[model samples]
Target: MAEGTRRELFTILETSSADADTVPDGGETPVNLSMDVRWFEIPFREPEEDEEQDEEDGERENGCRSAGGAEDTAGGRCDIILVTGNGIKHEEEHPEEERYYSVSYNCSDDSDIDFSDMEEEEHASCFGLDGDSEEEEDCASPHFWGEPDQVISIEPFSVLSGPQHSLGSDADTRDYFRLLFPDSLFEHMVEQTNSYALYRQRRSGKSDPHWHPTDLREMKAYMGLNILMGVNQLPDVDMYWASDIFIGNAGFKKTMTARRFEKLTQNLHLCDRESEPVRGERGYDGLYKIRALLDVTENTMWDSYTPKRCLTIGQGAVAAKGRFCPTQYMPSKPLKKGLRVWMLCDSRSGYCHRARIYVGRASEDATVTALAYRVVTSLVRGLEGKHHHLFMDSFFTSVPLMQRLLRDGLYACGPTEPGRRGYPEVLRPCNVGKLSPGEFYQCQRGNLVATVTRDSKVVSCLSSNSAPGLVGIGPDQEQQGEGDDNWTDTPEEGGVSFGVPRPLPLLLYQENMRGVDLCDQLRDCYPVGRPCKKWWRYFLWFYVNICIVNAYVILRESRGSVPPGGCNGKHFTQRHFRVRLAQQLIGDYQGARGMERAARKRHADSPIEYGHRLERMSERSRRCRNCTNKGLRHESVFGCKICNVHLCRGGCFSEFHK
Candidate 1:
């Protein structure tokens, strides 16, 4: 053969190398595996071609070796070289044929391969699924998580549809909602109102009340249920008229002067009435009557009762509670509307922007008086005998107003600054001297009842029979029989009085006790007035305001539509879920309706097509399983009768139809 340049031959292997510890090395010979590799051209020599040997023997066997031949071969006469000229030793003893085991492994290079760990020019937007590796080329393509935001698209479905067995999906709220909503609760409201009435009757000893001022003043001469409550109940609030204890205000911008209010009629619209400077008395009766009308819508039914045929209404309101300036009122004679209509307006303000439309027996005009009557509609119909306290401030604490309150079967009391003067003499000095200096307007004076010195006014009063008493419950009156016997009976009490008055009644009667916290007292209220909004923030402010004003304002923004039980945080999640479910239902309806337009829409968005696809998919899924089941084994007539889907006994044979 002609001589040619030599080329090198080497073997490259891909193997699962055994860890260093897996290999046995008793002597600890140095083994290096990660050495750098370099490529080079080297001279190689071809071995002489060995001819195939023809077997003269009958069987294939090992080389014939005589005793003499072994010695001859050991002398290095054989030329199958085991040592290289590079001084590297080669294995002289090769693997025995019997020890050899062949293992065949087949795997695709790309299968289960994690490209995330590979070294490559990563194009995040590119799917890398196709042969094309350019991201710019696929810029027009829609991909999940590629846009600014992404939302999972689910086809519309109804909770009520399908099987009733799957109600657990939204069971946390739906069941309770159905029970606690309009249906059951409507009737329940009437029941609760009646119960409240019964409670009020037992608490107030006067089963029947006289609206006459003369009767009220005469009653005050003697101890009323309020004076008795404090001595009856221990550690109870000294409550009298609910209004006296409750903080209340009316946020009204005097739009129409008092004269305009006196002559108010259906002909005068709230908007048509000028924004009369409310700086002077705008006739309090008209405005007040209007307020009352608005409040009574839910509670009263004025069809039957009539002691006072002519009741004056009051009015005036600001849009928001940001700016407040207290204004006085004058009752212009007696203007009556058994269920009269007067235009009461809430002026342009922030609160009005948020104010919702509240209707009560819609009359020609909606006013405060209308609201008041509406508030009592259900109460009057359900529980006519309930007594309510109509507390007021020095502003409305005139003896005459108290008489008016008595006419309505409501106990009236407030800080009698200058107006009220026909109450019985009280024990304690006026605590809030800042309100009215030295003179008291409604303190009890002997049995005849005198609106005496403010300094001598009772600090607090209660109404419940269970409330504590004044004289019977001193710190020394412990339960021991000795403490009980030591107590002296008063001749006024006939000396045969039950030495221990009922605590609840006594609590309501303790006019001698410390005055209540103005803020805390208004915890229960239908707010009437409020300070401006610029002055407050957060729920604390709202709560504080609610506590301060007996104005009867509904907390609308802070807590939207208080649940049946009010703003209870415990039901927060449930309420939220209810809202979500409602939103879902609405959205589904809209989508379904839009599709109708989509069918007609020539240039509808992709979402429309997606909706159609979803509808088709839903239709397919709802097909029968037993009769003509698409993905089912052959069956006779056991298919889903309603949906016409093929189903089997083994797979949900008892599914809901429709």
Candidate 2:
């Protein structure tokens, strides 16, 4: 080798030695193999006098030549070296028989190489640098690394699609939704309403005597009467007496004292458990307890006068403000932090058939369309297939919702958003509002129709069942003269032309959509509800008041149909009805226990145990003044020394005390 090429090779070997020492073992002892194949190459070359000169010329042309650097050695090139850590001298005495040292580089086609049996190490050996020396080798020459194994395959094409059968998919969702809803919704609503009373009865049966109310049923009646009689100005205790025992603002001596009234009302029990702080048990902590009463009352009202045809879905607000209050929008004022109730009522009698409190959206996936559908379906559950017409406001009106109702055999009509799917595009507000007043345009698609009328401004309504029939001249049209620009001049008949000019759909909506409003007006007459920390209490009172209204309506209808000398001979106002009801309820269990005077006397005369006892009075034994007041002078044998009064066992005992 030339002097400069020899120095360059030595310098490369020295740098490789330094790099090998710094390379980490990765916490493992790696097998070290050191081989030099240059000696084999040199030994096989023919010894020629001018061979050294040829090598020197080739080295000068390639700049710095290495085993893998020259393009002539690019194919199948690898330096073949074998240096075992176990010291063993190779028997190289027979060159042709020495298999380990006989290097072979196969440059032929490798179409039949078996790559399956090739280990990762064997593959690495084929392509990796074969020796520590940085020199290019010509594997295409007779002595070099073998060719590598290749792999090739063609894959067939496949199409990807959505699930054919999956849970909660659109195809499976309807049945799942049915499971979430009540099967017999009418019975479910009625059962919820009556659950409280049934629970109270069960609880009272198991409760201790101390937990019993003075009169459970009577106390409920008295509470109802107090609401109708009005006691907003009176103290809580005074309310009890003013509603039942007391007459006007009479002196205390004429009626039950305020202290006695307080004592009676305090013992009222609707549930068995004691107050929470006293017993350390949850006691009526949620709306569950009172909700039953409200629900039952509404159900009873519905049963008494079921709405047969038209019903309206409308919202009613309960004014409440607190962190716990559900946020509900109010069109009349600023955002009201309160609860809303969607009520369905009879169009003619204003009877509330069904109502649901807006607890929140049904779920995270709930949208405006979904909520409206849920409310409408829940309220009109049993009425499906009856072809009952339901009227609603814009908040709940939508094309899909109406289509679903029609599919269920119901007719729905209300003002809906123009952007709602299935709403006719030609009936857009701008397109239809170009007509003069009383001039209307309508578009019908299948069973659904959209009507646009330009009255004060523009009004659009969608109806699944109603049609835009012939327009008739209304009273307003009559007020406008024949020369009015909006009305076309038609031939007058007998100096007058009068025909209904109002759109039929608008007329029907005006008539049928007032059910909810009428129900609200009736409830407003005497709200009987008091401010409560718990929002549901207001609904409880509201349901009770409406029940009374429904009863009044039934009574009026029945009386109006009565012939001369009918059963309902006397007419009574709602207030009179409430007064009579209170009297009857209290009278049923009037004399269950003793009054204040009897208890006081018993305390004062403690040693006189036999002061009062049950004894029958004869016709002439003694004239009891209590009996004389009733036009009966029979002697009242039942007399108490403590109270120092005479009384008949049958009526006077309960009458005087209650």
Candidate 3:
């Protein structure tokens, strides 16, 4: 062999031998004889002329010639020999098998080894040494973590198609609210309520004589009273009808009697109990009692308004103290023990577009990612091909989910937990502390980008819709900076300052992920919810609050301009809208007073002894009660002195008395 190549081989073997000796006892001993010594030649004895000719021919056929030709082999085949620390010898007859010798060394322990002496071909040949070696090569390749600083393409958002309905200038608060809760739903409620009352009466075999079947008008009035109760809260339900000068709400007494309102509340039903499936039946539903109401409300929300480009997916809790199978306990949440609901809402207006009640986990082993995927997919079912960007939290963000959303033409951005699957190993929590405040590291896989940034603390985010780069603080943060003297452009010790670099995905998540929270805020402002023994009642009130918030948002948007007086303006705020809506819903609907009150009024009037006497009415004529009951609007100027009420002077007075 050549002297130069021989010296290099000897140097590598000596170094490997020294390294092997330093290995601790009972520890892994790896001898790295990494070199370009493929074939070697050593002269053991002289050969005959016939043998020399035969060796040259064999070398040519085998393509294993030594560096200086067949003369270096001393007219014989060359063989490579390697000796281990334990005096074991490994001899290779073929030069092609030399790579196998390198494979025997533990590649994991070669972190400090320099590969500069090895050719590109030799480095490439070491792929089979260890799986991690191949992974290291991949990590060094360009675009291995996807193209650096890649920007996601943004699609122009537009409402392509939805229910077409327009409100004119003459529209009232009731008109706007009916867009979300129409008259048909009220009729369905009335039907189910009357049926349930009849069923109860039959089962008891004794019907109360005071019970009267409710119609659509009375049911609407009943709903109106419920809404008004939210605005004028009292300690007890009957207090709204109290006749005391200090605490009485006369409007409640004017609309419906306390007894009748209580009766309607007791019999209120959204679905027929007789048709409910048995507990162990195949088609049993946990929410069957309020299923119709939920369906109608959800369908109406989708049909009423189209959401904007940015959306949010989150969970909400409806407080309840009833026996429910799907109640979850979340000590961190405000409504710690209650029913859970998943919601998808608009970021700009906080309008709920879709919702799903959490019944329970589908199975015991169901993963968190799987449940989040199902919820996001189910809520955004009809919104495909619309290019809506969704923001969520770590419970819902995962690498596979982001990829799936990208494939569906949807986009998502959110913070992710470090331990979540497919998170970049280079951006781990341990490395986060090494980054300076406002500094970030990102890795991309196709459209999905996983980013870790150091702010107040280490925050990791995964996104399919945002670019991977630093951005300045947002406008809201700038506003906050004005009040706080500590806010500045300069960085602090292990913390971020105002107007510093922030990850784009983190910014987007912060800006657009509060839709559900905003919805909760609006619902909590004048909460219509109250504690109830029935679990479905809590859900019913929750959906009602959602509908009211959504309706108010729609009304504000449809108006195109805010009134001058802020919340005090007519139909400006949710409070004004709800009050006006309740008034219109209760228009002209009256309930019968109790028999005691009627007899007391009769006894008080009988002592006057002014029976059947006619008296002239004052200003404008009122509608005759007898005529209005017959669907006629006959005005009356004459009044009965005995009754002290307006009536026609003829048979109408005698008919009202009868």
| Candidate 2 global lDDT | 0.45
Candidate 3: pairs in clash: none
Q: Per-residue lDDT tens digits of candidate 2, residues 1-658?
A: 4545332321111123344445332211111112110110101122234534554444433322222221122222222211122211111121232111111121111111111111222212111333332125431223332111121111111212111122222222112212222123223433442444345557667632322233344344345344544422354434434423233333222333444434433332233232323423555344454554544555554455545556788887655544454547777433244568789887766767777777667465258877887888888887766556788888888766775676566777787777665555445654333444544545444345566665565667777544332222333345345554432224342122323234545655766787887877776666564554545556655655666566555554444533223125354555555544444433443323335445453332221111233344443456665777779877655554446567665556545544
Residue 131 error, candidate 1, Å: 99
What is every candidate's alpha-carbon RMSD to the true fold? 46.3, 36.0, 20.6
lDDT of 3 by residue, 213-257 (tens): 999988888888888888888878867766454666767776776
Worst 10 residues of 2 by lDDT: 35-44
| Residue 617, model 2: Cα distance from true site in angstroms | 42
Winner of 1 and 3 under TM-score: 3
By TM-score, the better pick of 1 and 2 is 2
Candidate that beats the other on TM-score, 2 or 3, i.e. the better one: 3
TM-score of each: 0.22, 0.50, 0.66
Candidate 1 lDDT over residue span 192-283, tens digit each: 33343444456676642211111112211111121122123223221221122131111000111111112211111111123323435665
